[model samples]
Target: MHYNLRHYRAEAERHSHADFHQIIISDVGKLELEVEGRAGEVCGRRMAFVEAGRSHAFRAEGLNRFLVLDVNIDLAHKTGIEALWQSRGRASAYLELQNGAQGSLLGLLDRRWFRSDASEFTGDGMPFTNAIGDPGLVDQIRLILGHSRQAVGTEKKTGSDIPTRLVRVMDWAETRLTEDIAISDMARIAAQSESTLFAAFQRYLGTSPMRWLTAKRLQMAWFLLQDCQIQLSIGDLANAVGFSDQSAFSRAFSRQFGRTPITVRRDARKLLGAKL
Candidate 1:
């Protein structure tokens, strides 16, 4: 399984997920997890996991510095790396290793490749030697995983007034064009009903939720294309802006900007007089 680090800070409260398992480790501030039908608090040196398909929400009390992993389960299973998950379940306490150390461990356990050559082992074999490792630290992390699973959770809604809620929702929407955000989910984040959110958005932004989301996505796509270091193809650009298909991105770009992405990239270069 491959993973990317996604940082989040919820001024209010929100739920986040992709199509994979998520492991969140908090190193600063506090967050309350609202998972299933229960609620629990996690703070410094704490870790939590939200399994794929579970409905979980979190709120950062103030500032929150954390690391999140979206794991590829199928790949893990195919490669016999599921032992990491099993170890975690058997361990009953959360693990808090230094960032650099944890990064090393995660790279070894979660992927088919490792930065250090000695970390590789084939088949069901154990590749690591105990000489340079601490068995106690490993045991602690696994315990944390089990403890987190046992700690069920829910948090009270933010309960901001309608207008205030709508404003925050709009701000969040503008920032997350690449996310598979849903209207119902947005409504929940805003502490409003679907109808209330719809009416407020139309009144405030002069657009429906999806239309506004599409426009934001296009704007983000345009910005990314204008970045000189970005060498992604149209399909890459499309996926970056939340359109899973290149054709959809092309059509939407043409409709909104009156040109294809290639033309837009060209025009941006011409405007900036950038040599490529």
Candidate 2:
């Protein structure tokens, strides 16, 4: 398992994890989540679950505080909670853990497993060592797993081939963000016709292939600017991410994020300095 404390502004793309199941609990502010074809907002006492191999995306409103758990599928299976893993391919892609159980589980994860300052932790091959040794923690895990299984069973399953194809195309596109990717290329990668690919993107992601690619490239640039340890000029960064001109990249970045690239870098450095 991996634990993280996140403060996100917005994530404007539909993305997914290939393996680990994700459980996110909101501590402050609301999270807009879209999984499969369902959409919702999670806040207060609600928690969202995205099973392994499912397509999901979320963006925070403002100053969101949340805890994320990326639990390995193998660990769930080994713990005799294979139902959670099995539910991945089903149409019930998004599940919620609500009310008192949500609070209790968040408390357990926060107090026992997480550090506020640390963004992530890996189990180092030992999954839930403390939970396995303690009966109370074991019960808590069981309770959480039981709710997951119940949620999976309660939702009606729908059949859709477009999402699977879209996921395949997205996986291919993410790796080649800096390259000139065309709709035909995406279609070839997904084994669908260009028209079919366009329809899939429109129906599932609410955008065209090129528009989605642009958003992804911009998001990548935003992260690269915030990494102060990486020594790269703005022009180099722009060229590296497929933008041919620094001025064009700056304009695009400001339009998307409402802040200049220079401002973002400056603010990130200030934040880092404060942390130091």
The numbered model that scores best in TM-score is 1
Candidate 1 wrong stretches, greater than 4 Å: 1-162, 270-276
Regions of model 2 farther than 4 Å from truth? 1-162
- Ten residues in a row with the worst lDDT in model 1? 99-108
Query: What are the lDDT figures for the candidates, one per model?
Result: 0.53, 0.62
In model 1, the Cα lDDT at residue 184 comes to 93
Backbone collision count in every prediction?
12, 0
TM-score of 1: 0.44
TM-score against native, each model: 0.44, 0.43
True-structure lDDT of candidate 2: 0.62
* Highest lDDT scorer: 2
The sequence of per-residue lDDT tens digits that candidate 1 reaches over residues 30-95 is: 666665654565543345656666677666655444444455556434433235555553432233
